[model samples]
Target: MPNTTDIELRGVSFAYEGVPVLEDVNLSIRSRELICVVGPNGGGKTTLLKLILGLLRPDRGEVRLFGGPPRRGRLRVGYMPQYGRYDPQFPVTVTDVVLLGRLGRGGLAGRFAFYRAADRKAARDALALLGMDAAARRPFAALSAGQRQRVLIARALCCQPDLLLLDEPTANVDTVIEARLFEILRELNRRMTIVVVTHDLGFVSQWVQTAVCVNRTVVVHPTSALDGNAIRDLYGDEVRMVRHHDFLSKGGHDDE
Candidate 1:
């Protein structure tokens, strides 16, 4: 079942308040494929993820997950949005935040129900996966941006999803943390499909098999297509292509 298609978007177009975002987008993601979505700012990267997650209805065409509507299949999908969107003022502990991922697992009516022992165990296990177990009881707001990002990833992992979606997973972390994070993700990809939305290709090229370049329109390309010309076609010529090794060696901030 490794070749099983887990996500598909056919002629999908979307708009926000009458402004066109994605247009006639067609994308297919198979099981256990590690993908990185890259694009310039305001290029509909996050919006595409939302559409795949079933959070937004496409203005035209269709989005399907696991051969069904997104709503039905999103339960098996884990999502981590951008880190900048949070206020970092939550009084909840790290464990409590991760448990939020289990919400609605038992359906809408059980959303507020007490967390089962299994749920707590799953949360702990996810935290452990991110090496954040020691800080499980720490105040969420007190952690640095890197630590919070790890906690959020653990939250997404708490679902034990068949598909995992992440936005700007390496936004605040340094190169060292980014390397470690990708190491964990590469390991996770053995069991689940991963679609990461990041701005930089070099940071993720070592792990991702494909690159989904998003803009007003969407295009899917193999990672090998990421030469200077391809990058300029997506980004402008002003942007330089950074090799993964050169980037890590420079200790560059690969923020999104």
Candidate 2:
């Protein structure tokens, strides 16, 4: 499955309560690909992710993942939403927060019983991957924004997914944090496909060859092919590119 098609969308159109959002969109994401989903506000970027996740039904056309319906294929996917719905006052520990991810695989009964040793190990491994293992006992609400983001991403990884979806993982983080986030993403991309939804047009990770632009419709363009016209089409003429280096590193991927 190293080079197999992981996600496919064909002639897909979606409307929310009769308001047109995306129309006639076609896309394919291959295994182990690192993709950035970029577009202007209200351009249906989030909507596109929802469609692929099977959270929303398309008005027309087909959406497929791993050659099947998203609901089935999604078990292999890890998702980090644009927003963390947790109340800041909620006193959940970092490890507890991550264990929530295991619910999908652990079943509702596991929620009442103690987590299995395997589940605990998975949670620990996920925390270690994000370099937050040291803070596993910390309160979730007490962590900084960047730290919280990483913890959420760790939760996503707790599912041990083959496809990872992150929505604005760098939204409010500083450039340093953003850089670090991408560094982790670079590492994660090796055995799994990654889809990042970001507004950062300057996001030029060397390994990210494709930027899927969604603006009512969808367009796939090479990062190098994104010039002013493409920027204008995606963001309505409000952007400037800032280059960043030192993201990719040589390594073997998690192809298993």
Q: List the residue pairs that clash in candidate 2.
A: none
Candidate 2 similarity to native, TM-score: 0.83
Question: Could you list the CA RMSD of all candidates, in the order they appear?
Answer: 5.9, 9.1
> Model 2's lDDT to the true fold?
0.81
Give the TM-scores of the predictions, in the order they appear. 0.86, 0.83
Model 2: per-residue Cα lDDT over 81-169, one tens digit each: 86457799988999999998787664666757678888999999998977899999999999987788888899999988999999888
- Per-residue lDDT of model 1, residues 128-192, tens digit only: 98889999999988999889889999999998899999998988889888889889999999999
Question: Which candidate leads in lDDT?
Answer: 1
Work out how many backbone clashes candidate 2 has. Answer: 0
Clashing residue pairs for model 1:
none
Best by TM-score: 1
Model 1 global lDDT (CA atoms, 0 to 1): 0.84
Model 1 RMSD vs true structure = 5.9
